[model samples]
Every structure is written in structure tokens, then in C-alpha cells.
Target chain A: MRSTVREADRPWARQGAGQHEGRFALLLLLPAAVVVFGVVIWPVVRTLVVSLYDVDSAMPGSYPFVGLDNYVRVFQDDRFYTVLGHTMYFTLVSTFLELALGIAVALLLNAPLRARWLWRSIVVLPWALPTIVNGALWRWIYNGQYGALNGLLDTLGISETPTQWLGEPFLALNMVIIADVWKNTSIVVFFILAGLQTIPSDLYEAARVDGAGPWRAFWRLTIPMLAPSIAVVLILRTIEAFKVFDIIYVMTGGGPASGTQTIAFYTYLQAFSNQLFGYGAALAYLIVLAVFALAMVYLRILKQNQLAGVE
Target chain B: MKPTSPSSGSIAGIIAPRPTRRGLLVGGSALGLSGLLVACGVGGGGGKKGGGGSGSGSIRALFMQQAGYSEENIQEMTAAFMKANSGIKVTADFVSYEALHDKTVAAAPAGTYDVVLIDVIWPAEFGTKNIVADVTDRWPDDWKQQMLGGAVTTPQYDGKFYGVPWILDTKYLFYNTAQLEKAKVDAAELDTWDGVLTAARALKESGVKYPLIWSWQQAEALICDYTQLLGAFGGTFLDDAGQPAFNQGGGVAALEFMRQTIVDGLTNPASTQSLEEDVRRVFSSGQASIALNWTYMYGLANDPKESQIPGDVAVLQTPAGPVGRPGVNGSMALALTATSENQDAGWKYIEYLTSQPVQDKYALSSLPVWESSYDDPKVVETNPAVVPQAKKQLGDMILRPQVASYNAMSQVLQAEIQKALLGDKEPQQALDDAASEAAKLLES
Candidate 1:
């Protein structure tokens, strides 16, 4: 009777071994799933939930569910639109300037210039410096009374009086962009230089044989080949510029009026300065949507360009 | 051997007897969950133990950045407090003015601080939210007369005092004595807005280029400057019914006067971007003949090591306008938090920090809130020019609205005033917009 009972459980036991291996695999993956759920998924859900309520920090338990009213208020705010315009202006102008300067510098670095290694090393120092340090450095350089820039302009006989680089509205944004370009162009240069290195020498030789000058070869071969790298830089810089706060906060405090108040600065003012968390959250989500849409457009362009290149 | 069915006896049955797959899965999952739960429980327990046990003896105090309230001074004060209270320890933290209110609001709920440096205008919000404890009956019987009347009342909400006023502060009109003498303008003639502008004209004639420098940056300083001017012109920001009335009365005239200062080049065009420190630097550098700045600049400008014009500085009452001479209170106070576990120790620390002797010691850097400290020998000797003017200014000082909504109101007013200053909007339209927006914020 003992032998018969053992025989009956044998098939079930053999099958259990194979199934237990699968169970072990799932157990290994459980911690990773828990971490992803906690870290990535949770805050997003919380932000969304909080966005739909009028959250008063002083009265914690008394948040009223306001549906989409907060979003409506953000849209109705004139400051929101003004800030959005300024953000776009800053992103496009700064990114374009960075890209243009970056390509030129990268090409120079690629050339057989004297002390090429030293130049390559020194070019990245600006990018390596802390952003706060850069902001402070530029602030002193652009001071209306005691700025190096004003001193230079005076010495060069550019203007008689000091230009209020950070006080005038258009001038302030342009000055911030100049500082941003000085700090960020090096990153673009690094990326493009790497991309330039990946291109085959024979392609340039073929273009040269086809009676193309350096400028034409750059237009026809260099740019087309470097499209992917440029797209990546554009997408990264656009996202970064869209969310810029620190430089503006440090340089101008979004001031001389709200001339430099980007969407991010305005959102911070709403959420922290005004203590209007609901409105700020709604504004944040709108920024997220805008950024997501921008990213999608860049990705599509990259894909299409690759497809055209392949064909 | 043939693949054996478990139901029948075979070699496979003897080699592979095992637990069922379902049982193994359930057991493994339970073990993993329990491990995670145990880890979380351990962390939480450790945190609670730290907060409830050893941390109960030490208190943390948060302060806003100020000249007299340096980290070194704070450490000395903390050391003195700890020395007096044998077993207690105090930790200090400092934040800049821009981040002070926000940081305190965020930190208070977490019980992160036991004592906080409260802005004079913040008691209404802090008291209304129960962020700080009420100490209405804590003062000694003679405290009412001992402290300045405004200082005593500035931190009260609902007839309850929430803090002890520490620094007695207000704005002052500072001038370069050499520049005034060079321009041949009597200091008494520079007692009104017109007089200031006329003096600017005289200083300009004497080749000073920019005669009046203002701390007109679009920040709390701008609001302070505007409010002082508004009060000087006999304007009230809020009505008897607790409504915004800044756009009415002499508000436009006050704003226009500020705008004209820039327009007439009496103030540096760059003054629109200059903070109080910037204006002080401009004055100390002898680039400007007159400056409107905090009382701290007076001390700095007189010190030979700190000032370029050490022998050529004078401070006076914030010049009078159409109605009277008025200044805005920039006083800061210390408050005990309700959430602190060691409230008694926190109160002791505050009491010692604000005591007359300690305050007198700190008076060279920060004016003492106690009215009697002005007569303290050291204070009188160190800051002789500042004491009498500060005493007189503290008497006529007007307070910005002390309400829960003052921060939001100040922000709106600042933006509107900045627009007018930047030439984006006319003064009347700017005030009207600010009035309407601030009214809505107050209502909500």
C-alpha cells in the first residue's frame, strides 16, 4: 500500500519541478516590478490626482475637487501665454545659436589645427562647469555699472553709456541666451565632433573628386550624415530649454519686470510663490504635453530623414 | 526506464518527489513580501526611534539671512543658550530672504524646525495656520512699554502674540555728506519727494549725473519702497472693510513720483534693476548722491574698512511726502513652533536670544527691538547716527497688510508696479490692475 501511494504522487511531483522553475523566475522579477511601480508610476499618478484639486497647504485636509477648473484658470491667465511665448523665443533662439556655433567649432576641432588635442580638451571646460557658477559669472560680466562687457564696449567705442543687458526686456532675454549659448554650445560641439568622426573619409574624398569644395561637401555630405546627431541635440536642448529655471532664477529673478519669466518660472511662482499648487500642477502638465508633442515631432523628423537617407 | 506515471510505481517516483508548484509559488512570494515588509518596517522604526528618543533633547532653529544675523553670530548665540541650559543643544539653519517664507511653510508641517525667524508680516499667516504657538501671556508685565509699540503689535493675530520681535528695522534716506555739501543743498530741504527731486537737480548741476538711487528692483524691496511712499502720500492700501484701496487716494501720485524719478534721471535708469545692496554699493562708491536703503547700510557705510566714503555718510528719516514721514517695518521676530517636541527648550532658547543683554550685544549689527536698547552704551557708541533716526522712524513706520493673503497681494502689487516702472503700463492702470487682482486674492 505504501508503494502504491508513492507511485500516485510521482507524476505530480515530477511536473511540479518544471513549474517551480517558472515560479522562481517570476519571483526574481517581482522586486524590479515593485521598484518601477513605486518610483516611476506613483509620482505621475499623484501629480495627476493633485492637479484636479484645489490644494491649500495651510488647510491640508480641505482640498476641494475642482475638475478642470485649474487648467481653465491657467489658460485664462495672460501671464501663462506671455511666458510660453518667451520660453519658445528663448529655446529657438538659443538652440539655433548653439547649433550654428557648435557645428563651426566642431568642424574646426576636426581640422588639423595646431594644438588640436589641447583645443579639444579646453572646448569642453564650459560645459563641465556648474550651471550656477556660469550664471553668476555671466551676471557679473553683464552688470550695468561694473560689467566687463560694458567696459569692453566702452573701450571699443561701441556705445557711450552702459547697456542694461539684464534690465531691458528684449536685451535681457538675448543676454540670457548668449550666456546659455556660451555654456551649452560646447555640448553640441562634442556631439557633432563625435558624429563627424563616425563619417567615412572616402565619402569626403568622393565629394572632393566630384568637384565639390569644403562648403559644398559640408552641405551635401556632412550635414546629411550628421542629421541624426543634430536631431538628438535639438531634442535634448529643446526639452532642457523648455524647462529652464535656474539660470533665469539666478540671473534676473525673472525680473526687470516679468520679461524673462518662462513657463517654468511662472509655474514656480504660481505653485511656490503664490501657493497655488493646483494651478501650478495644471500648468506643469500642460508643459509636459507640450514637451511630449515636441519630442514626438523631432522623433518623426529623425525617422523620416533616416528613411529618406536609406532610400 | 520508461517515463513513469506518478500514479504507478517507477524509478522516477523515488528520484523526484517534490512539493507542488502552487505551494512553492505561494511560499516564495510570501517570503519575498515579508522581506520587503520587514525592511520597510525596520527603516520606519529606526526613523521614529531617532525622532522620539535622542532628538528630543536638541532643537533646530531656522533663520532668514540678515547682516546682523550671520551664521557666526547665530552659532555664538546658540553656544550661549546651550551653556545656560546645560543639557540642551541647539542647531541653526539659515535661508535667504526669497526662500525663507516658503521653506518655513514646507518645513513646519514636517516638524523640521523648533524655532523659526518670522517676518513681521508673517504672523497673521503663521498664527492663522497654527504653524506657530501663541504666547500672548508669556511676556513680562513691563514688556509692553519695554518694546516698541509697533514691534509689540506686529506679531499679534486675533489679540494673541505669536513671537518676540527681535530686530527693529525700517528704511532710511542715506546721503553722501560730501555730495550734499558739494551740491550746497541743506539736508532739511531734502525732506519731501519734490525736495528730493530738486536736490537731485542740484546734485546733477554739480556733476553727480545720477543724484538719487533707489532700490527699485521688482521684489519685496520694491513693494517696501512703494508702500513707504504710499504711506508718505497719505494713501492706504486696504480700506476699513478690508478691501484693496491702493489704486485710490494718493496711490497714483506715489507711483508716478517713483516713475518720474527714473524718467527725470534723478535716479539711475539702472536703478529699476538695483536691489537695496546695489543701491548701497552705488552710494558707497560715490556714484550717487542719495540712496534709499535699509538701516544696515548706515553701519556699513560708516565703517572705514567696509565703506569707500567712511567719513562722508549720513542717515536721516525716510523723507516725508504729501502727508507725513512714513517707513515700512522690516523687523524680524522669533517664533516657537507648535509641532516642536521640545517647546519648553525652544521657548527658553528664544527668551535668551531676545533678552536685553543679548540684544544689546547684537545691536551693532541688528537694531534691538527693545526701545531701551537704543540707550545701551555700546549701541549708542557704535551706531550713534542710526539710533535716533531709527527710533523716530520706528514710531512713524507703516506696516504692510498683516493678513494671510499678504504674500500673494505683495506679488501682484510688485508685478504691477514693475510693469509701471518698466514702461509696460501706466501707473494708474498698473495700480488698478493690482488692486483688482489683489482684491480677488483677498476674497479667495
Candidate 2:
């Protein structure tokens, strides 16, 4: 009976020790969590709550609860659906091109080259420029007449006439994407280059010794090892592209008949231009859900690749 | 990790585990709850600034800094106003024209500004929304009588005056005299759209790529052009009930004329994207034979430093239509906010700014609404190009629809017209669609 009582007391003592340890750990994490919640999570939660009601920032205390009426209206809006489609289309096409170009550039940089540091720094210049400045610079370049691009084309005798790069509806999105890719591909290249560095050079040497060609060695050794990093880059680029607003707003203003209006631009218009804050919030949440879903898909792909590696 | 088991007990003898998981769960929840509490506190902290005491004793005037004006103008105006009124201090916030309008719309109802300089079109919306004070009771009979007829009529909403139009603007056609001579077309004959089109064709046949140039792209520019044509066609945006009636008759006819101009190869496809500055560039570079823009372009077009076609440009009223050559009125009006504690001081500042003597001083940069300023020798000499045409167009100055949702309604109409110009939709379909959409917005 004494032994059993002692055993019972030992577990209680251990639990108290565990509780102390847990409290210490929580205390260490509390500051960071508080900062994040204050800056990010709180706004998101407030936005979610506000989306369920009709609220106007102009009339602060006049908000009345309307349940999910805003959300229902958002789904019913043709503009919302159109903008969402544009956003997805932009993300898919731009990210695909960026990944391809980024990987190609990273692979080229990985090769034994002269003045490697200088080349690497030069390649990163575009990504370092501010987005708005980049947009303005590109707008000047794409000017139909007297633009550097048209000047170059004219010099090369590529065409007899200058192109209205931004004015034409069919060409405006592509022009914007070109500007975006020019500014952002360097970032993706940096990530891919870092991932390339993590792969063991000895593995490539072994593959070469086994008579594998350059293409085979890259496919078998390089790509498999770089899958995880690529996954991260894909997720980040997709999220960023989906939230694209500044460049489009500055360049086309979603004009020439709403050809370039993306979900982000549409939300901005609804909130600030139209002063429909509730509708803006609802549209924002839809974007959040879409991005989260894509991220989950990428995570599953990462898990599968990792499992295959383990096997 | 091992799965923990619960203790089975009898009535007298039972032993229980430590229940660490449940304890951990409660602790975790408490941590999250504390985080949420901190977040709520942070959000709550930002709201206090909104409830602070309203500004008193000093009148805050929000004004636009025109492109050519310097900060000294603001200092001088504020100092002069303050010197005249010793009891009240004047504080002025200067912003760009576009930004001034946006900030007023955002901050008016929040009582951020005591007085504001609103673009003339904004009164229709701001007045109806109760963001501006009704000045019918405060304005002196003499001051009201001194204003231009059109200027006084601009700010009336529901039979009450909400603002005083202090600065006026009108659209005019700026033709290159040299280009017309080179094309061998008489300038006097270019008084109608057809005559202008015929001259433009001759100019184009004489090796000109873009014969007639205008900024027909942005919503404002489109509306200005439409206004000139609509007036010529005897069109009105509103019926007696104040409902939009622009879809049929003259409105459609005006739209068709614009479409015809685009199709006839007289206007550039790129004009669909051009703004005021771009239009100025085209005319100033001598690339355009004729340009339709505001009267202010006269000085710019004659400036050798800016314009290559100096001494070769002339300003005239936009060509006559079937009914008449109607001009669109673009003006900036001064208003006291409904929340202003210093309404008297605000009104006094506006009076100083709009007085004939001060108007003469600022005449080069602004077209003053004071009837006396039009006849002032100093003003006449300073803005000669505009003074002549501006006086003539004053009686014919047609204000756009004075509806509360003017911006939204205008945007819908412009977008549809833009689609028609771009060949995305036919003229009738675009007008019908725009009318339906505008009706929905009006109903809402």
C-alpha cells in the first residue's frame, strides 16, 4: 500500500514538472504569436467578421448585421467571377513561365563561368527595383510611338508600324505579364540557384562516371533533389501573382473595357472606388480560400515527392 | 507517444491519473485566448483617435495645388486671409487636383476638413449626401448677384445652394494654323464636325498620319467630348423627373458621330488611351492638325519651350452641332463643411479667394467666376485666349447631370461607349446596356 501511494505521488510530481516545462515553452512563443496575431491574424478575422455585415467606413457607427448577404451577393456578381478568372489565368500562365525561365537561368548560372558573381548580381537588378517604378519604366518602354521597344523593333525592321502594346485589349495582359516576369523571375532564379547549391556535386560525378548524359544526369539527380525548393517557390509565386494590383492599376487601370481587371483590382475598386466595403471583404475572402486550396495542393505534391525519395 | 488509459474505480477504492493532456489543452487554449485579447486591445487602441475632440478656433481649408502653382501661393493666401480676420487662424492643406477630390470624398463625412475646394461635378453628389453645408441662408444677396449666371446655378440641389463656384473652365478646339494652311483648308469653314472631318481628310491626304487629335480615352475626356456633341444635338441627360434620358435620340446620334470619326481614320486608335497631357503632346509636337481640349492649352501651345507649333495655334469653340456648339462647364467650387465649427471664417476665406482683385492676380492660372473679373483689364491681358472664348461660352456652358450618383452613372455610360468605340459592341447595344446598368445603379 505504501509503494502504490508513492507511485501515485510520483506521476503527480512528473506532471507538475511537465506543466512547468510547457509553461516555459509557451512563454517563449507568446511574444512572437502576439505580434503576428496583432498585425495579421486580427485584421483577417475582423475582415471576415465585417464581410458578414453591411458596413461603411464613412458612417462608422451605422453598420447593421446582414449575415452572409454580402457573400451571397459576391457569388452572384458577374464582375467577381470575371475578375477571379483573370486572376487565376494570370497566376497559372505567369508562374509556369517564371518557373521555366528561373530554372533555366539557375542551371546556366550553376555552370562553370567567368565573372560569376558579377553576372549573378546583374541578373538580380530587376528584382531589386520597386514594383511601381518597374511598372512606370515598362509603361514608357511599351509606348506605341517613341517607346524604346518600338524604336528597337523599327530599327530591326521587325514591322513597318509600331504596336499599341498597352491600348489593345488582347495584348495588354501579355504586356503586363512580361513586365511582371522581368521583375520577378530573378527572385525565383535566386531560390532555384540556392536549391541547386544544396545538391551534392559528387552525385553528378557518379552519374557521369556511369555513362549518363547531361540531360539524364539533370533529370535523375538535379531535378529530384530540387523538388522541395521548387514547391516553395511555386506556392509563393502563385500567392503573389493572385494578389497582383499595383502594376495593373498603374498601367492600364483595368481599362479598354475591363480586360485587365483581376480579383485584387476588383476588390480595390469595390472598397475604395465604389465604397462597397462589405462586397470587397467578401471578394477578399474568396481569394484567400482559392490561395489556400492551391497551397494545399502543392503541399500534397511535396509530400508525395518526399515519400518517393524515402522509398 | 503512448495512449493514456483512464482509471476504473469502485465506490470506495479508486485511483486517477495526472490528466496531463487535459491540463495541456486548457493551458494551450488560455494562451490562444490571451493572444486574442491582446489583438482585440490593439485594434481597440486605434479607434481612440477617431473620437478625439473636433478641431476648433482654426479653420482648415483643403485646396488643390494646380500644376503651375507653388507652395508660396498657399502661404500667401493663408497669410492674407488670416491677416484680414484677426480672430481666426487659417490652415490650408494643398494636394494635387486628383488627390484633392479623392481625399474630400473620403474625409468630408468624417469631418476632417472645415472647408474644401470641390470640383464642380462633386457638389451634385456631396451636397445630396449632406457632406457640404447648405449656404443659401448664409450667402449675401449682393455676392450671389455678382456671380455668373451659370456659376450660381451649378451648386443648387433640391432648390438649395450647397457651394459657390469660384473657378470656371470650358472646352475649346485648338487648331494648328500652320497645319490648316499646309492642307489648304480654310480655318473659318472648320466650324462643324462635318467641316472639321472634311478638313481632316484633306490634311490626311496631304501626308498627315493623324489629322485630328483629341483625348477621347479616359472617362472624363470622353464625357467632355460627348457633352460638346450632345449639346450640339440638343441632348439632355435628365428628364423632368431627374431620370437619365441619354440612351435615345441625340445621345445615340452623338455616339454614332464619335464612332464615325474613329472609323473614318481621322482619330488614332491610341486616342482611346490618351489623357490630357498626351493630347497636349500630340498638338504641341505638330503631329496633330486639330485638337479639342480646354482653353488653358492656349498658353501651353504658344509657349516655345513646350510647344513646337508656337505662334501657329489658335483657340475656338468646339465646332457647332445641329442644335448648337454646346460647351461642357468644368469648374472648381468652394464649400464649407456641415461639421465646420468656423463656418464664418471658412466663408470669409472663400470670399477673399474669389474677390475680383485677387481673381485678377490668379487669372493666368485660373478662370475666375466673378463677372467683374471677365472685364478686368489685368485679367483680360493675362488670359486673353481664354477670356474671349470663355466669356462667349459662359452663357452656353452646360453642366453635366447633377445627380447624386453622377460618377457611377458616368462611368457606366463611358465604359459602354468605350466598348462601342473599340468595336466590342454595337452602338445601340452599348447604349441599351449602359442605360440598363445605370438604371440598376440609380435604383440602388
Candidate 3:
């Protein structure tokens, strides 16, 4: 230690050791940095640039630069507003239901129970399956004529006439929400459950001693304790729901009158299907700004928590 | 309880930094804005898009897997093509019909494919955008005359030949023969739209809940079905000055006729959600007695493994409306990609695939486009039931509007048409709304 420690205390030797470890750590991170730059940073920059041009074709060509025109056009589009309304409704309803159901499930799971591991494992299964698979499964189930839903309804003798689950616009959108909630609620439950465990048992006991009922305790204690987890889950689910595409693509193809068309799906149609890449790029940037605003809200909550010494 | 070190570089500050919202937003926005400006023109090459190369080399082709040539048939054809032209090697990629257009467009800039199979509706879009090579000079003069009229017109846009028409197709009326027999509806009674409705009513009375099914989903499939009916009812997509005319007269009538069938419970309510494949499955399972589908469906629907009513399936030309009977031209063609370096080789591959001998061999899967091949005893023997209808119907095919904005226009129409079918809007109002929207698209 005296011969080598000399390095720990000596400035020159310490600097040399730090340099060596820093270089090695940097080398290890190089691949990840390259991937992020290539996929995320590069595409984002290019999309922003593309949004400023009238580049219609995917092929390389001379295009007219129309700075900020596409962004202005986004506000003027009637279809854009229609799809935006749908996306907002989809996000608000889906997230609210998921949070409510997730908290309930998380409390149940957190409670002392039989086969806790087995129940926890079962709860994670829906989240384990990919969204696309879940969508296809739900689509088949919702098929109007030969779907499992109709078959089940018939067998249960609840309805004689087959309901066209994905046939009408409004009904199809709600059905898709039901499908999305079934799959995504599992993740929310896990997040809430993790938060639930961090809640001290003494808080509930003290609330009880103070003459608080179970509901009052949950409202006053459990909910306040779960704020950070709720904020985290809210941001994640909100962004994802706002950008919902694959599930809609598989289940509905934005149809029965473009009923389930989200902003992302609409952008895909503009960019790929309609070859309006410039317009699509602008739409994409708007989505980013929207998600950024949501993240801002989350960060504000996080800052508040830190200031209150709640962490 | 604890004093805070404000310096962000300190360990305590770094562990849980109290970054203000304004600072982060401003930082992120500046970073994004700087990157955007710096990256401007990164994707632009200003390079010319179309050319050809030496006549022989490796070539790749893109084809739709769902319809037209079966993937197995295509592979076999490619193998034979390569065998004959040893100087050229061929690689074929298959996607669903829904994916074919986007894949071709995405691959165009990179020159990923040497050849691509294009739907009849895409010639205008591809040709105008230069995604496909203009091969008018390469197309032989005699080949045009030798091909069926519908097939000859398939690859044409603004008087230019964009490709070689290969898979000739039109939707033909397919019905369950045994069911029609049980309903005592004569096959000849299905000749006209009026008579067809009467037959559907009789079939419905004969215990069929919905006697008619259609490929009427909110998709291009719906447009194809609509186009056939639009032509039958004497509606033109555009007038002489290129103004939208589908809102008037026959267009509204065709839509009304469609809606009336649903209101009468003759057409399946699920038709609003079904594509060609769904219609095939419904008819094959004996759930629906009548449907309109392409030539390939005849083979699949009559196969014992694919259909429950295999031996009882029958085919006929599309029923006539007040004006005439014209099936939707659901044909596709083979074209050289504009960005292909091996375009000469690609054209050679296309020629081989579209060759009369090659088409005649796969007659069971898709009928030949060559006019003379229809008369070939060998071709007729491949499928006796569909051949006669093909002979009559192929000559009378109707095309959708050939415009660069056809896809967008079709989407507008698809939505409004679905509204009418679902009884949300009246037929006239729906068509009117669609026409207004399509007019704006066409103008742009």
C-alpha cells in the first residue's frame, strides 16, 4: 500500500489511474453511444430537417425548403384535429382505468396471500406478451361473425344477435381500449406493487389508531405514499398511449371509418401510405413536443417531491 | 436536516440534482434546434433516380404473397427463369398485398429491388414519381395487340407504358351451386343486378341468413368492389375536364343499391369489416351463398381442403347494372425499378415471368393475360369452371381512376362508403362528401 498507495494520495499518480479507468469505461460505453447516435439522434435530427422541406418521395431528389409551413398546416388540418381528439380520449380513459385497476390489483397482490409468487407471476403474463400479439388475439376475439366474443355471447345466451365488435367507429375504439387496458394494466400493477411494499405498515396502523377507516386510510396515507410511483407510471403510459400504433394496426387498420386512427397511425398514412413525408415529419415533431410537455409535468412533480424531502 | 451543496459537480448534487424546468426545457430545445440545423441536407443527395445497367447480373424482385401468383408458383417460375438465363441470377421477396406498395417505395431510394410487381392502380403513382422505369420503347408493339384489352391497358399511364402486364384479373361472381339449387334460383337469373337481388332474396328465404357477402372493408379492396359497381351503374370517376363526377347520378345509385342490400339483410353486416380473404372464407364455409372474388379464389374455393362446398362452387361474370357489366380490373404487372442498377437483367426476368408459356403453366393459380392463351385447350383444361367466365369477363374489365393521388382518393372514398354501408350517412351524402374530399386531393 505504501509503494502503490502513494498513487491514492499523490496527485500525478491519482490522475494517471483515473485517466486509465476513464478511458476503459469510455471504451465500454462507445458501442451504446454509437447506437443511440445512429438510431435515435440521427433520425430525430433528420426528421426535424425533413419537416422543413416539401420532400414528397422517399427517393433522394431536389426538394423545396418550406420552413415552418408544415407545422402551420398541422393546425389547419381537419383530419388532424379529428385524430387528435381520438388520441386524447384514448389516453385519458385508458390511463385512468389502468391506474384505478392497477392500484386495486397491486394492493391485493401486496397483501399477505396464498401463492404470492404464483399470483405475481400470473399478473405479469399479459405484459410478457408483445402488444402486437395481444392486438391480434383481441382482433380475432372481436371478429363480428366468427369471433370468439360472439361465440361466447351466444353460448352464454346473453345476446342472440351477433354484435359487430370492430365494425362501428366508436364501438371499435372502445373495444380497442379494453384490449389495451387488459394487456398494459399488468405493468402498472407491478409498478404500484413495488410502491406499495415501500409503504410502512406503521402508517396504516397509526391511521387506524386515529379512527381512520380503511377507505380513509387508503385515501389519506396509501395514495399520498404512492404519488411518485403514480407519476412515473402516468408519464410512461401517457406517452405510449399517445403514440399507440401497432395494436391499432393489427386490430383495426384504422378503419370502420377511421374510428381508431391515432395521430401516430395518421402520420404513418401520411408518410408511408400517402407519401407525404414532409407533413408526416411535422406531425411527428408535434408528438415529441406533446410527450415533452408531459415529461415536464412529471419532472415538476419529481422536483416537488425532492424539495419536500419525500424521496 | 442537511445543508445542501448547490454545485452540480459535487457528489451529493450529482446524485439527486434539482434541475429547474426552464433550464432543462431550454437546454433540450436548443440541442434539438442545433442538431436540426446542423443535420439539414444530410438525407438529400440531389442524385438522378432512374437508369439501366449491363443486361446481365444478379437481380431482386418483390411480389405480393397474398394474391395473384402464389409464392410457390413464383419460386418455381424464378427457378425456370434463372435456368434459362444463366447470366442473370434472381432473388424474389414476397410481402402481403397490403405491404407491397410501401415496401417498393421504401426500397426505391436504396435500389433494393431490381424488379417489382405493381398493382393496376399504382402505374400512375409509380410512373409519375419515377419509382418504376418507363419501358414504353422496350415493350414490343405486337405484345400489346396479343394481350387482352384490359391487360394491355394495365401498365399505361398518360400514354406511357410503365411495365409489362402479367397477372390478368377481374372479380367474378362466385356462388354456392348446391345452395342456389336448393333455393330454386336459376344461374341465368344471376345475370343482372336486379335478377341477382331476386336470387339473393330467394336464397335468404331458403334459410341463408345473408345470401350475399362482399369484400367491403375500409380498404382498397372496398374500392375495387365499388369500382366494379360504379362502372356497371354508368358512373365515371372524372368528367372531361377532370372534375369529380362520382357524386352525381350513377355513383349515388350504386352506393344506394349497396346500402339497400344491407338494409334488407341480404348482405352480411360483417361485409363492412371483411376483405377478399374474409369473403372467401365466409363463402367457403357455406355461411354466404354469393360473393365476388378474383380468379385465384375459384381454385381455392373449389379445393376440398379449403372449402366445405368444394364440389358445389360455381362462377359467373359480375351481374350487370342499368348500364353494363364490367368487373373491376384487379390485374397487376411486372416492372423494372427505376433505381435498379441491373434493370436490363430485371426486364429480362420480367419478360420470362410474363411469358405466355410461363403464364399458361400457372394457369391454375392465375389465368393468362395473353389473348390467344384463353383459347388454348391446355389453359382451359386447367380450370374448366373459371375459364369460361374469364373469357367473357376479362374483356370487360373496368379500371379505377388512374391518378397520382389515387391512394389518397381511394382512402377518402373508402371511409365515406363505409359510412353509407354502416347506415351512418345516406348514400348520396356520403358520395358527396367523398367527392369533395377527393377533389381537394386531386387538385393538390
Highest-scoring model, TM-score:
3
Question: At residue B208, what lDDT does model 3 achieve?
Answer: 98
DockQ of model 2, rounded to 2 decimals: 0.25
- For residue B420, model 2's alpha carbon misses the true position, in angstroms, by 0.9
DockQ of 3: 0.48
Show model 2 residue runs off by greater than 4 Å.
Answer: A1-38, A309-311, B1-101, B105-116, B128-138, B160-162, B335-351
Count of clashes, each model = 3, 0, 0
TM-score of 1: 0.88
Worst 10 residues of 1 chain B by lDDT: B42-51
lDDT by residue for model 1 over A241-276, one digit each (tens)? 999998988788888777888999888887776667
Clashing pairs in 1: A7-B6, A8-B7, A11-B6
Candidate 2 per-residue lDDT, tens place, B291-393, comes to: 8877667887899998999999988877888888878877767888776666776777777876777767877666777888888888899978778877888
Which candidate tops lDDT?
3
The TM-scores of all predictions, comma-separated, are: 0.88, 0.85, 0.92
* Residue A13 lDDT in candidate 1: 71
Q: Which stretches of candidate 1 lie over 4 Å from their true place?
A: A1-39, A58-60, B1-56, B137-142
Clashing residue pairs in candidate 2 are none
